[model samples]
Target: MQTKMGLKKNEIDELIDKAWKGNLERNNVIALYNVNPIILFQLADSMRKKVVGDYVTYVINRNINFTDICIDDCAFCSFRYNEGYILSIEEILAKADEAVERGATEVCIQGGLLEGMGLEDYKLIVTSIKDRFPSLHIHAFSPMEVYHAARTSEMDFRDVLKELKKAGLGSMPGTAAEILVDSVRSKICPHKISSDKWEEIIKEAHRYGIPTTSTIMYGHIESIEDRIDHILRIKRIQKETGGFTEFVLLPFMSKNNALGRIADKRSGIDDMKMHAISRVLLYNVINNIQASWVKLGLDMAQLSLLFGVNDLGGTLMEEKISKSSGSEVGEYLSPEDMEKLILKAGRIPRRRDTLYFMV
Candidate 1:
């Protein structure tokens, strides 16, 4: 078979086999640009099967946006605001209770950086959550939040992380990372922490035995090379600390935001192709790549399964950040719906925890 781009089926298969064997070179992966979508998907699917098998992992988690108040008014964000009422400790605990009652194993608690909030406030929140739901995995905070806490508390980043961990923080959610290139970040999120700072924080987290997921937000004012650089940086870190659990690819949803006003366009097939390439390139540090159903919708997310994504993200109980960004996709998902989506894509689905363990 010859693809639309004239890439032979056997050649794609050979490349996939080499990638699985860890023998594919960077030049070989770059050569895949000549391959068409159909063959590209084929190679991605074959590689997924060879390494991770047919088990597509989904987690039972809920995103609790503790507050929308943010100091960093990123151009691409619809949730950040300098003025907004922050969630009280009682309200946060209420949300945590709701998540537990709804059968969620993980509670991803995050919020914008409030200028006056100290490390004591974060400790109070985490301690209260663990005091109530001791079993619930607390995958809270991003590097940006940590950076903020470090600054507010007038302590080093490591000290803040250590205190938070003692207060029962489990993992980092990997959101502050929009893209690791400072050039793109300077253009889009100048107020946010720099890329090097984010890397240092994540590495420090790993050093302290805290595992975290890595993420990329693409499709707005970033070059393909920037995307590649983002993945490569994560790959290098994972190589050093072996701390990343998985990689999530978030497409830029250009609507109801500043970037959207500049150019209201979402990522297309090319975006999905880059996701596939990430799975192929980060072969050593990353074993599982997740497709965000909330952003891509069910159809495109299922298509991403063929493009080297082995995970369908989570059965998010409440996802306000992405929805607030103008994603029309539903915030809640049932276990049955998750299995059905994976099966429809001709793969097996397994529920997992933050650690990617089959639950």
Candidate 2:
């Protein structure tokens, strides 16, 4: 009756039931991995059905990396250069205009931390974009970028977020949150904000009514326990602030990056496990689990539906960060193509805005 890991089968059954109810302990959470893969996936699919039914969602958005010039040298970066390029206001707005022309509902903006790009510079981008296209939702900036700008402007993080929100910032992108474990972050991105600092800034944004998505970058030096810790932290934040819109599982794309040279490579099963376990652990706390199609590749992303993924992220009319890390899936996926992938997976495709509302 005992499995190889020494837990009885009945114990795993109870664990699965507890996971369904969002009550699994830390040890039990790890034990779920040793449970039959089919059973684990089934549990996730069942959870997805109860939470979101058979509908799969995707945002028709674009990624605008306004600058590639960064100061911090993260070991996992393949996108930064000393003084690469910084788009002017006219150039940024022009990209927005092109995005609008191509039927994008939102524009996701993020880039490196330049020396003098302070709060005023950040606000200028938001305000000008809003002024030009009054209807476009601007999902921009990471917590680290906020911290950097705050330091540069000699302003508090809350004050920076308040200014950006006032300037039409729709939401914040939860990047720069690689593993959220201080140990892992120390190795991958030593100069980035600490995990506790990241939490403080995120909670501040949520308290101020600025919603943000949560993310984790795995498949590198981080252990499965590290990922669970990251997930629990997200769940705790949602419990306290009710701010996270969705939880995104971003696998580490290990190519053309320094971290890749020494990081562990994940198998196909690992990708599915990350999605399935995230769904089981998150349960009702964070209902939407997104699988990044660009990083997972189209086929793997589509396969994730059975593993409890309900969102395929965005069309990403243009994506550079992942591309720089050696993603060869190209930069775009049309709305029609998005729907086809969802339909092929036997789920209904629902077009969504940045905030997950039907468009």
How much lDDT does each candidate structure score? 0.84, 0.92
Query: Clashing residue pairs in candidate 1, if any?
Result: none
Q: Candidate 1: what lDDT?
A: 0.84
What TM-score would each prediction reach against the true structure? 0.93, 0.98
Per-residue lDDT for 1-359 in model 2, tens only?
88767778899889988987778888888889767788789999999999999999999888999999999999989899734999999999889999999999899999999998899999999999999999999999999999999999999999999999999999999888889999999999999999999999999999999999999999999988999899989999999999999999999989888999999988989999899999999999988999998999999999999899999999998899899898889899999999999999999999999888998
lDDT string, candidate 1, 89-161, tens digits: 8998898898888888999988988878778888888999999999999998899888888899899989999
Cα displacement (Å) at residue 250, model 2:
0.8
Error of 2 at 175 (Å): 1.1
